[model samples]
Target: MKVKSAATQVHREQPLVLGYKVDIARQESVKAMYDSLVEVFNARLDSLINNTAQMEPYKPFLESDPDTYWRTWEVNIQGLFNMARTFFPMLSEQSLQVVYGEQGLWASCVNPGAIKIKITAGALEAVRNVLPDRLAIAGDTIAWLASDRKEWLGGRYISCPWDMEELVAKKDEIAKEDALKLRLVV
Candidate 1:
């Protein structure tokens, strides 16, 4: 219901916006979405933000249902992988435009720092004890990322709590250290 309401609101704001229910964990579903998108936009996509995730109810691992625990991994990891793999061609097509000096793709995994949403309000009530960050922190960060302003951050993980100006200042250092990527630390 929340998803539908959000979609309706976006469609109201932008008449061209199209919404479809998809199970990202399924390859066929992802393909259908890709097909629909290709048909609508004539095989052109400027940007793709893969933001599908799932969280099982907060519980101890030993007490958690095995299926439910794995489901979160399926949606969070496999779903994101499926979306990225399926959309790579269209995304690459957009990148090709860079040959002509046009702005290209800027993709990243955004961690919208602990904002209070439906799930947070319910399943994550423990967060209620802590002050949640404003929605604008994530919204503004994503808005900046959608623009051509920060291509260097592509293929990186970005936290909404990080200051963009500070991030930019340390871009070289970040690249040198290959930071912001998932890696095992000693």
Candidate 2:
């Protein structure tokens, strides 16, 4: 349960897995971040997942530099890529079930305003296309189509107490996906 900057390496002796806070503002930083993470978890981890809310706000420089935008994209988008590729095999049904418990916070389109919505939505779409089913996805907010259809990676979408049941239902859906996706193996 240790949280560290993306640049840091995971500590091998720590009993709990490591979580890196990525800054999606620079491309090189993203590469450096994942490279370091991969190095640590290559053989040491039993399972791997990410808490997307850990991504920091988009910096003003992110818009100014095309390279930076793509870098942010890599961190937000490719970060998932690296995580899945690096740790997909280690994830199993039991491991996936408890991996994300109480560790995530749902993000709202209003939390960081409209810009985050666009970026997060774009990244989410990209991951959905390439992501393998073996890993579990946990997130704070559930994105829905205009028809109220939930996205593939389900989570709670609303903030009020009345929505708790809906959130629980969505959580169940995600858990099922986690199991189905990993069905090929144990």
Candidate 3:
């Protein structure tokens, strides 16, 4: 009886490569996000021009803690920006724009009466702008070409109000934009 080593057995079992066309779509997506961030950050810094004070704190942290900041930004805002930037164009081209609303709007209207009315109104306005009529009109043209359906995605944009209320309460204590930039980099 011959003993086949694990490595040799695994190698023999593995499938042979054929006409391989490795799709690097995900890698491209990640690279696009990185490039956009670099562009936006550079533009933002350039607009400040000679403001050394603005970049002072972030400079040290940027060199030391890029990965942490990248992860934090990726989850908080960059991810959203990247997804919208990439998918929105494709969706627009394909004529599939789905609009969703936050349930908080209705909750605010029902509870606390007038106190929450303004917030709810603002939220509604934001929602409206996100799914503007003009975009919808263009979507119709793309829909015709792609044979896609035009519809509202419809979901609760707002989750819990408690977190927002807490943020509002502590707004004064929150760090300034420059401090935040430094913290984010670190």
Which candidate number has the best TM-score? 1
> Can you write out model 2's per-residue Cα lDDT over 1-186, one digit (the tens) per residue?
223432246543434444455553444554566577557756333323343433333346535657655565766666656655444434432243112334331112212222333234434455545543221111223222112323333232333212435655666765665522322345
Each model's TM-score? 0.78, 0.33, 0.23
Instruction: Give per-residue lDDT, candidate 3, residue 18.
Output: 22
Order of quality (lDDT): 1, 2, 3
Global Cα lDDT for candidate 2: 0.40
Write model 3 residue lDDT over 100-167, tens digit each, in one string. 23211110100111222222343344453454233233333333322332121112122222244453
- Greater-lDDT candidate between 2 and 3: 2
Best by lDDT: 1
- Candidate 3 clash total? 3
Off by over 4 Å in 3: 1-27, 30-70, 97-186
